[model samples]
Target chain A: MSIRYPNGKKFEKKRIFSGQKNVNNKDDRFSNRGMSLEEDINETNDYYRAHQIAVIHKKPTPLQIVKVNYPKRSAAVVTEAYFKKPSTTDYNGVFQGKYIDFEAKETRNKTSFPLKNFHEHQIQHMKEVMQHNGIAFALLKFSLLDEVYLLEAHELMSFYDKQDTNRKSIPKKEIEERGHLIPFGYHPRIDYLKIIDKMIDRC
Target chain B: MSIRYPNGKKFEKKRIFSGQKNVNNKDDRFSNRGMSLEEDINETNDYYRAHQIAVIHKKPTPLQIVKVNYPKRSAAVVTEAYFKKPSTTDYNGVFQGKYIDFEAKETRNKTSFPLKNFHEHQIQHMKEVMQHNGIAFALLKFSLLDEVYLLEAHELMSFYDKQDTNRKSIPKKEIEERGHLIPFGYHPRIDYLKIIDKMIDRC
Candidate 1:
């Protein structure tokens, strides 16, 4: 059983914990105690749901089960399973009657965000989302610098599609220029929808 | 590990195979070579994607992985896992810039559709979807009668919320009166989108 992602990264069930990022704090709406990027986004989504802001969720990791034990008088147990490559991005939902789709990734590299973090199908799926007039983007976090940016699908594609000439990764400088810096806050740790609101208003 | 889902149903990996549903037939669009409701919807989704008509997909089953092994010079293998209850419906995507969400269920009952097949979270999720102006529905298949209907989320909730006053299951006559009959055809075996088109037109 191959529990490797298409990007060749080992699949570990998300196991991050932040002792400081108190999710139950309703009093503090703009304080960021710090958390992993995925944790921040998940917290933000829960906030969104609680406040009826929008409906977004992270899709579960795809898996291929090869064997199972259906013992009598008890619950079934998965004996052997393998991770499978996902055909679409991680997060999707609706806000203001528009369909939103995006993928989130983080890197410790200080200079560039590697294109290899994204798989071929993810990019292709984003393109298809855009073709259908859905809002598509990538939430990139430069963990070493504590910087996060919302880059539209087209901008990422521009770098990816010109791979013959471009570097294997997107330079931090280019991301800073083309992407919108996502601000952190107290309640919804990563306030991404604010950027979306601006994008819609500007358009 | 409890592999029994919240609905108390035994969880097993999808293991259905149909010898007749020719998914690759481009020339013979609309041929209803019989298939399971889930299979028909999946094939329809694939066809819609190939034609650039829509971008719907069934979400992967959620699982609670407990243990994984990382062997040297090879891939990781998930050795122990349990099925986790899902928070949302099975299928969702963007179609004509509209956010569409739905669950497909099949029952052998000829006279009624049981409400137990649905969970509280799914109903709550659909309500949230509708609140945000997204499309929400259920693709119900009465296997014994080969009758399928697209029942909007609100309608399902009406009976669900009035559990004390109403029968546990929705009568077939009530469904026929209230739900939109989903027509099966050659290309996309179940043509629910056509009903959506009519819904938009009438509105």
Candidate 2:
């Protein structure tokens, strides 16, 4: 019933998010366009895990907890904490003997995907993954268009290196030409692994 | 200067761990045996990551946070949370173009390692990794003996299955004969990767 936080604090139970009213329609929950890129990817990963097809997971958001309060007969409360930047990509796991790693991002822009969404450390992490021969890519979800693209890290890095002189965003045309459009469906939602299988075949 | 926790609460700065006296000698910090097995592995992982040897990481402990308190002008603090059992093994990464997954545990028992130390999900996760042709193993640290052993998951599973009728522990003698003894040193403390290299060569 109780849990310990990383800083050894007892996390007590409290009700938050009471402002949002409940949606009675179950179908609306599945088709909600308001879902974040992380939520969509999590759903896809859950499907993959349930079917024994792949084992992919989003790394937990790193936190630096500073203060904890232990009360008698109650769960410990984390009185203070801060989020920390993660060193690795958001998602990583194994599929068919190969290591798969990727970051999922959502963009509101209809024409281009901004490169500023990624940090230097994340790009460096992707480069290291490629150096070790693991499959590395990014899941760019265009919220306005409802389209998802699986772009290889090498392609992203190539454009990133040119950002100093060229445009700071990847043009949609360029992404369409270089990246594989991940087919979205009901079960196993994103089906990015299918594209990965093809990529492995080509390699 | 500040960061947010998952819950919406102001995480004000506070001082904890005030009881521990500071050590003046910095060199003694690295040689401290008070380091937990998790800490040692984390240090080893840091060294590996810095040198670009391997990208192994210890997944953060999973927590299911249910409540938060958000105060104006401060980071959110998680008021209530529950610890969730992880669905997969602790450590996993790519090394030498191969997917590597393993769990690390330290035991005080001198003669045998209790099978109860492993969860059913962890064993199942390792089996799935092996089924996909990935290298899966367990790093068992005999704390009393100051020794570590890298035992393959297949071997561990065989012993685990016999727990119903046989003794619910892996005898140290059997482990000594079957598991590879991991060499320990200063720079890259527990060199379990060396054992992994040997395993890869045989494959």
lDDT tens digits by residue: candidate 2, B6-58: 56222211110111111112211222265556667878988988888888887
Model 1: how far residue A114 lies from native, Å? 0.6
- Tens digit per residue, CA lDDT, model 1, B123-192: 8999999999889999888765677899988898888887763577888888899999987777887888
- Candidate 1, residue B167: lDDT: 73
DockQ measured for candidate 1: 0.48
List the TM values for chain B, per candidate.
Answer: 0.82, 0.82
Name the runs in model 2 displaced over 4 angstroms.
A1-35, A67-79, B1-32, B69-74
Clashing pairs in 2: A10-A76, A12-B80, B8-B69, B8-B70, B9-B69, B9-B70, B9-B75, B9-B76, B9-B77
Strongest candidate by TM-score: 1
lDDT of each: 0.79, 0.75
Error of 2 at A26 (Å): 13
**Clash totals for all candidate models:** 8, 9
